[model samples]
Target: MKAARFHAARDIRVEDVPAPGAPGPTQVLVKNQFCGICGTDLHEYLGGPIFIPTAPHSYTGGQVPQILGHEYSGVVEAVGSQVTSVKPGDRVSIQPMVSPRDDYYGRRGQYQLSEQLAIIGLSHPWGGMAEYSLVEDYNAIPMPDDLSTEHAALIEPTAVTVYATHRGGVKPGDSVLVAGAGPIGQLQVMAARAAGATRIFLVDLNDNRLEMAHRLVEGLITLNPGSTDVLREVRARTAGGVGVDVAFECVGAEAPLGLCLEAVRRQGVVVQVGMQGKPPALDGFTLTYKDVDLRGSWCYSTLMWPQVAALIASGQLPAEKVVTRHIALDDVVEQGFEALLDKAGTQLKILIEL
Candidate 1:
C-alpha cells in the first residue's frame, strides 16, 4: 500500500508501506477513497510534533512517522466479527477521535473532551491517506445512498461548523456575522443559515474569499475590513444598528476576535470556532459593559456526525459547492497542501483521491 507519512516538520514522504492487518473483533478495515487535508495537518507539517507524538501517545500508543489525514471517507473492505452496524462494501465516513472508554469524559458521553483524546491519523498506526486503514466500528459512520463518496468526506469538517453554529444558539430569523472566509468560514455561513438565521454577514480582508462566500451562500452580505468599516457596515445593514444576534470568529487571529465582539448586538452570543496559535488579550470592559455571552467552541461531539450527514443528504448543506480542487494522493504535498499555503487565495477544500 502507498501512504504519506510524516517524519518531521517539513518532512512528509509518500512511499510504499505494508497494508494494515485485518480488523480486530470491534474494528473495520476500510479502503480509502477521498481524504481532505486539514489545517491541523498543515500546523504539524510546518512546525509540529504538536499532535503527532514524539513519544508514544497515551491512547493510540503510536508515534511519528505518522500518517497525516483525518477528514476522509471510504468503502468498507472488511469488518470484524462483532461489527454488525455496517458490512463490507458499505460507504462510510471516518470519525478520527479516539479516547479510552473508562475516561470520565467518555463515560459521560463527552469523549471529545476526554483528557487522553488522540486522533487516528496523528496518533494511530492507520489513516485515510493510505490505501487502506482500520478504525473502531463505532467510528465508521454509514453514508446515505444519495451522497457520493467525495461528499461524504466532508462530514467531519461539516460537523465542526454545525456544532459551532449550534453553540451560538442560532435561531430562526436571527441575524449573524461570521468572521473570515476560509473553508470553515464558508461552511459557517451555511450552518448558520440552516439553523434558521435570516440575515448573514461575513468579514474578510480578501475580496476573493468574500466573493466566494457570497457566491456559495445566498443572501450573505460580505465586507472586507481592509477597505471599509466592517462594524459600521454590519450595523447599517442590520436592523436598528443593534448589530447581529450572533457573531462567529472563524479566523484564528487577534483582529477577527475583536471584530466579532464589535459586530454582535448587546446580550448576543459570540462563538469562537477557529483555533488561535497564541492567546489574544480580551477587552474586559467591553464584554462587561455589553453583558455579551462570549464562549469557546472546540471539536464536535461524536453524535454530530450523523446529523451533519443527514443535513448534507437533505441538501441543506451543499458541501461540494466549496470544493475548488481535487488531486491524486501522489500529488497531495505539491497540489494540495502547498496550493492551500499559497497566498494567491484561489483554493478551498482540496480533496486527495486515493
Candidate 2:
C-alpha cells in the first residue's frame, strides 16, 4: 500500500508500505477514498512533533514515521468477528481519536480529554492518506449512500465546529462573530447560524479568505482587522454598542483570540476553537468588567459525530463549499500542503483523492 508518512519536520514521503493487516475482533479495515489535509497536518509538516510522537505514545503505542491524515472517509473493506454495526461495502467517516479504555478521562466518558490520548493518523499505524486503514469499530461511523465521499471526509472537522458552537451556547436571534476566516472559522460561521444565530461576522486579515467566507456563508459580514477597526465595527453592527452575543476565536493566535474578549457583548460567551501554538494572554479587566464567559473546546464528544454527519447529510452544513483544491495521494506534499501556505490565502480544505 502507498502511504504518506511523516518522518520529521518538512519531510513527508509517499512510499510503499505494508498494508494494515486484517482487523482484530473489534476492528474494521477501511479502504481510503478521500482524505483531507488539515491545519494540524500542516503544523507537523512545517514544524512539529506536536502530535506526532518523538517517543512511543502510551495509548496507541505508535511512534515516528507516523501516517499523516485524520479527516477522511472510506469504504469498509472488511470487519472483524465481533463487528456488527458495519460490514463490507459500507461507506463511513472516521472519528480518528484513540485512548486507553481504562484512562481516568476515558472512564468518565471524556475520552478526548484523556492524558494518554493519541489520534489514529497522528499516532497509529494506519491513516487515511494511505490505500487502507485499520481502525477500531467504534471509530468508524457509517455514512448514508446519499452522502458523497467528498462530504464524508469533512465530518471530523465539522464535528469540531459543531462542538464549539454548542459550547458557546449560541441561541436563536443571537449575533455571532468568528475571529478568523480560516477553514475552521468558516465552518464556525455556518455552525453558529445553524444554531440559530441571526447575524454572523467573519474576521480575518486575509482578504481572500474573507471573500470566500462571504460567498460560502449566507448573511455573513466580513471584516479585515488588518485595515479596519474590528471591535468598533462589530459594536456598530450589533445592538446597544454591546457587540456580538457570542465570539469564536478560530485563528489560534494572540491577536484574534484577544479580539474575542473585546468583541462579545457583556455577559456574552467566547469559545476557543482553535489550538494555539502558545498560551495567549487574557485581558483580566475585560473578563471581569463585562462578565464574559470564556470556554475552551477540545474535540467533540463521541456522541456529536452522528449529529454532525446528519447535518452534512441534510445539505445544511454545505461542507463541500469549503474545499478549495483536490490532489492525488502522490501530490499531497506539494499541491495539498504547500499550496495552503500560499500568501494569497485562497486555499481552504485540500482533499487527497486516493
User: How many clashing pairs per prediction, in order?
Assistant: 0, 0
How do the predictions measure up, each by TM-score?
0.98, 0.98
lDDT of 1 by residue, 1-354 (tens): 999999998888998999989889999999999999888888888888888988998778879999878999999999999999999999999998988778799889898999898888989888889899999998899988888899999988888899998899999999999998889889989999889998899888888777777776678898888999888888898889999999999988888998888788899899999998899988878888889999899979987877898898888988877899989888888998888888767887889999
Flag regions of model 1 displaced more than 4 Å.
none
Please, what are the lDDT tens digits per residue for candidate 2 over residues 1-354? 999999999999999999988899999999999999989999998998788888888768787899889999999999999999999999999989987777788788888888888898898877899999999998999987778888999999999999999999999999999988888999888888888998899999999888888766678899998899988889898989889999999988988878998999899999999999998888899899999999999979876777898898897888888999989999998898899988899899999999
* Shift in Å, residue 259, candidate 2: 0.9
Report residue 10 deviation for candidate 2 (angstroms): 0.5
Each prediction's Cα lDDT score? 0.89, 0.89
| Candidate 1 residue-pair clash tally | 0
